[model samples]
Target: MTMKPYRSMLFVPGHKGAWADKGVNSGTDALILDLEDSVPPVEKVAARDVVAETIDRLTGQGVRPDLWVRVNPEETGLMNGDLEAVVRPGLAGLFLAKIYNETDVVRLDAVLSHIERLRGLDDGHVKLLACFETAEAMGSCEKIVAASGRMVSALGATGPNADAGRSLGIEFTLEGLETLYMRSRVNLALRQIGLIHPMAGVWQDLANLDGLRTFCEDSRRLGYRGLVAIHPSHVAVANEVYGPDPEEVATARRLIAVYNEAEAAGSSAVDFEGQHIDIAHVKTAQALVDLAEAIEAGS
Candidate 1:
């Protein structure tokens, strides 16, 4: 089944089952119950069951926000266990971490297919979201996203002081000039496959809502449709930043109207509120309007 793009994907420690509800209550568009870095090694096994149950608990007929789980990396010898435990009916997708290249996604796709069959799910029912953490993954992002039809979403995930920054040996900045090229490439990869709603990474400063907003704004300007949030407090900021404001949507509608009027009068383009409006501008405006409608329908 196809899913909507999540505006705010908030991470919750899988072992901390109680926090899942708290995260949902924070108004996140999706809940990523994690069994990866957030969970201690000793509790890794247990967290799988916790996340599975959490999915079962929160998911129901007509559930609004979807549930996604971030399983451990294949190298840890724990991904199989993680998938076996949580690939139940309620799971919307799997966030595959430490992805290196297209081969990794292909292998996981096969495994997920097998699990879906076992769980009585339709083939390709469970989608995959790629998390570009390592340098290899970042560089081969285009191939990875294009590798699998089940690859529903892909994120560049270049958070400061985190796996990406450490792996790429780039310093994080609020202006994001250091990873601008990397981000631009990833954004291009996303657009190459028509996955316009690409998501971006963690904002480490949990208490700094302003910083979070800045990071989200940077992503928005760079063409990201959503964000991967670490803390519940960041959910609102992510939603607000990535989502279209009323005025923006209204402007898009007006642009569409003006373009239609110009075309009816046999003009290919015209001045739209002092800005040139053409087919290209109408298309862009239509996209914003479409996104606004999708968000409204989902809400």
Candidate 2:
């Protein structure tokens, strides 16, 4: 699978033009222009117009970070209009919300396929971020991912969803564990299909800095590429959680250097910091370096 570093996925309201620009400029790996929850009921149409205009402005200005739009769920009044306004050039993918099953994914695939054709783009240029928020979606996450045409870019789920075990009075410790399991399943499915890493979910609180950090760290350990950010303040935490730390980068460089030296001597592994470094360790170290560089370059 082609790796796209989405260490930070910051959500910007579609109606807020200035904030949209700020979000892109924020040190996030990706900016998700949200047309769903961040937007209100009455302002949906205006939000679409604002998002389209912002996209046009960004494209004209040659902004480079991966851009995506979180469309309202299928069957919502704004879903079709969201697609119409958000499917312009330079769009990296779509953040499909409230995906209930594979059928919904298939329908969206067809819709995106049609939209691509109408716009004279490649039939499958636009990818999807399947948001598995419902119990049905959680149960069928693997199948939903498998059925996503062109492969979905990522998978996400929320903590307060009606389907979460937390809804049954389970403590967050257990709930977080469940979330980890669900995210792991989704990640495994995406990997099996050879797709990019999946996102976890939005932490929902902007002021609870500790909560955000713990949640992001949890997601990172669960194998999620990143956590979704509802507030720009959370972007830094998300990026830090997903990207390699300075110490980690330094260690990786050292391991890589030692491994190369050993390979030059016809050895398969090298001892570094009292630990044996093999090809897998070297590859992982290089990946960490790549992720760090991508974050610095904002691409």
Candidate 3:
């Protein structure tokens, strides 16, 4: 599976068909048609069918952002039915909720394999976006991520009063000091395992756009590659905050140029902008530029 850059993933209630189109037009990198939280208990089955039809509609129109489904947890006994309804050609993958350990991921992978074969999709075509909303999941972050090649990214930012907060009993704050340790641990595990773009969870205060921006900026600075936004309004904020700034891109290009010139002159390092730069710095600059270029092309 090709790894797509996900700066922002907007959540659309699976039961609401109109919101899916709005979500796609909201400029998010991807859309998560949620069958778990947003849909009421009585509507879960109907929501699955709605999500399936939405996937077909979006793909038939050749939409931009990828479509993902947030399926019910395995414990619910509704996941199998959810998967059956939404695992189609246009569907990108699943956003697994309430994962506890590697065993959960392994079971999911087995199910995906069977689904792909049944649907005639390529092996591993249905990727996973794992959400660590429980204390056990956070404790076993490394194992969970390493469990499946199908996981595109692992998320550790379950909001306050949600699964993680309830399980861990951590208070939520704007500064995020309470969950800092867990977030840092998850980030480190992802980096160590080579999943560079782990997603931060949703900012629930929908009315406070400024607060949302601050939360996203903080996450970006903390090495999170993107955010999961519940509202369409937060989409642009995530994209901008996670994206390389114009000034940063220009500096990266200039740094690479200076480094190349230095190397041509029989020098492996160069004094550029009052700082000494070597091949390591050049590689970083090149990477930033490459990311910028990719984002531009995708846009």
Candidate 4:
């Protein structure tokens, strides 16, 4: 599946199939059907079929958002069942939950390859999106991410009392300086691997749109191009924060036009609205325009 540089991916509880419609209507860039934490112990087995049906229905209806599944980890002895149920035609990727090291990465890769072939899907048909939520995972993130060619993007996994905070034995803060080092390290690892559009977080506050907006803005400033959201309402906030807004897109187009004109006149740099722009600036502007176009084309 081609990545959309998702601005927001909302997780829908696998057992609550109806909520899937609500998520699609909420304008999220993608849907992560949860067969892990959101599902209860009693519903774990049955929820797999429900999630599979939801994927098939959405795919049949031609839903715009790419569908993903957050499968159970191997420790639970339920991951094999989860993967068997969800890795089909409609699945775009899997959120490699609770990955602790490169060993876990290789194991998951092998499992995915087996399932893909067994189901008549192409080799590497499904992609992996790593989650750095445990201390072991956090410490060896670079190795884990590089362990598989199936990795497309990763989430830094910061949250209040979530696995990340609890595993690292840290408290959460609105300013986020407490977890800044780990988050920053994840960003650096992604950069070294030549991956752009690194993502982070789950706001966890369903009612506080204002606080969620702050989290989104702060994440964008930290070089994260997207975010993991639990609620659909958070989608608009994320899209706005990580946006190549209309004005930015317009300015980029104008800058490209002006720069091209200057080059034709035998100049290397030109003043554009009090800012000196050169080829470097042009490349940045073009990237913004391209992202804007992609977001426009996606659901």
Candidate 5:
């Protein structure tokens, strides 16, 4: 699987085209043009057009970050119209909101296939980032993620008082201990299905930068490769937490060097920085170095 580095996916209101450029400049790895909750009921149709135009404009301007649109749920009659308007060139994928089951993914795959054929785009060119919001969706997380080859990542595991919280009736807390079970289950399912970089949902408290940092750090520790940032201030925090630390990169390089020397000397194991170094350790070190390099190159 080709992994895209999405350390920070910033949400931008589709109705506000001006915010698109601001989101791009905010240093987010990707921008999610939100047409579901952010756009008012009366402005949905206009927002789609605005989002499409902004996508075209961003691509024309040679923006580096991938652009994704968070379309309304499949149950909404507006999903088809939103897809039709935004499936043009420069759209990276769709952030499927409020997905309930594998059936939703299958239906979306079929729709995307039809759109690709009509638009002359390559098959499976438009990826999917499924949002598991409801209790039903979370229960079938594994099946939902495996349902579509176009699905690149999953989200909505921890959004408080939103789709997930409201669906589960869980209250919001900064500690996030309440949603640990759900988050861990979702993360394990994603990993089991080979979706290594599934996104942890947004941190709603905009005033708490420290809390956001702690959340990102905790998410990273739990094997989340990225996060959805509701504010630009959280972008840097996410990137910093998700990206490899300088000390870690240095240690990885040293580990690689020591392991290589040990291997060349006809030994399978060695001592490095008071830790037992072996093939498995070396492989982990190499992956860390590679990730660090990829982040650096992208930056």
Candidate 6:
């Protein structure tokens, strides 16, 4: 799989057009112009127009960050119109929220394909990322990933943050442990369908750098490729968190060089820096080296 590091997916409120510029300058790999949770209800229409205008201006100004637009949920009357305004060539992808099933994802793909065809652009060229919230959606994670096909690549799941806090009569803090489990389930489900590495979720509290760092490390350990951040200040941390350490890279290179020499000598296993090495060792070393290269390439 081609790795894409969604280390920092910063959210910019749709109404704050100025923040669009500020968001790009913040060095986030991607910015989400949120028409969902970030915008007030009454300002939806105005915000929609503002987001479209801001996107065009950003493109004109050569901002060129990964521009992802988070549309309101399908139940919201604004989804269709919001998408119509924002899904241009300048947009890198769509951050679809409240996706409850495979059908939701398929419908989104169809819509984007239709838009692209109407514009005389190639069909299925747009990228889509779906958010899983409900317990039902969590249960159907494999189906959702399968239904996405080539158009859908990333899957994000929020437990208490989106579902439990709003639905299951649970407190946010009380649901943290469950949220981690929920996230792990989704991550495993995605891997089953070959999307082994994908962006995790928004942690919400941008100022909690310590907590953020801890969570970032946790995500890395949990097989997550990267994470989503809601603030610009968190970008550098995200970028740094999901990569092979310099020491690890050096060790990987050493392992590979020694292993190669041993293999040329017809040895089944080799000793490297007083440590025994075998096929498994070489495989692990190669993976680390690849990760280091990906990080350097800003993947």
Q: TM-score per candidate, in order?
A: 0.94, 0.89, 0.97, 0.97, 0.97, 0.88
After superposition, the stretches of candidate 6 with alpha carbons farther than 4 Å from their true spots are 1-3, 61-64, 151-162, 168-176
Q: What are the candidates' C-alpha RMSDs?
A: 1.7, 2.6, 1.1, 1.3, 1.1, 2.6
Over 109-176, each residue of candidate 5 has an lDDT whose tens digit, in order, gives: 99999999899999998999888889999999889988988888886557766778888898878778
lDDT, candidate 2, 72-94, per-residue tens = 88768778888988897878788
Instruction: Report lDDT per candidate.
Output: 0.87, 0.78, 0.89, 0.89, 0.88, 0.75
In model 1, how large is the Cα lDDT of residue 250?
Answer: 97
Clashing pairs in 5: none
Supply candidate 1's per-residue lDDT for 6: 81
Ten-residue region with minimum lDDT total, candidate 3: 1-10
Judge candidate 5 against the unseen true structure and give its global Cα lDDT, from 0 to 1.
0.88
Residue 141 shift from truth in candidate 3, angstroms = 1.1
- lDDT (tens digit, per residue) of candidate 1 on 2-107: 3485889889999998998888789888889999999999999999889988888888534567888999999999999999999998888988889999999889
Q: Can you give the lDDT of residue 262 in candidate 6?
A: 86
RMSD of 2: 2.6
* Cα lDDT of model 6 by residue, 180-292, tens digit: 76668777777777675677666777588887788788777777777777888888888788767899889999899988988999997988999988989999989889767
- lDDT score at residue 53, model 4, on the 0-100 scale: 97
- Give the lowest summed-lDDT range of ten residues in model 2: 162-171
Q: Encode model 4's per-residue lDDT on 36-69: one tens digit a residue.
A: 9999999999999999999999999999888999
For model 3, residues 73-146, the per-residue Cα lDDT tens digits are: 99999999999899999998889899889999998899889988999999899988888888888889889988
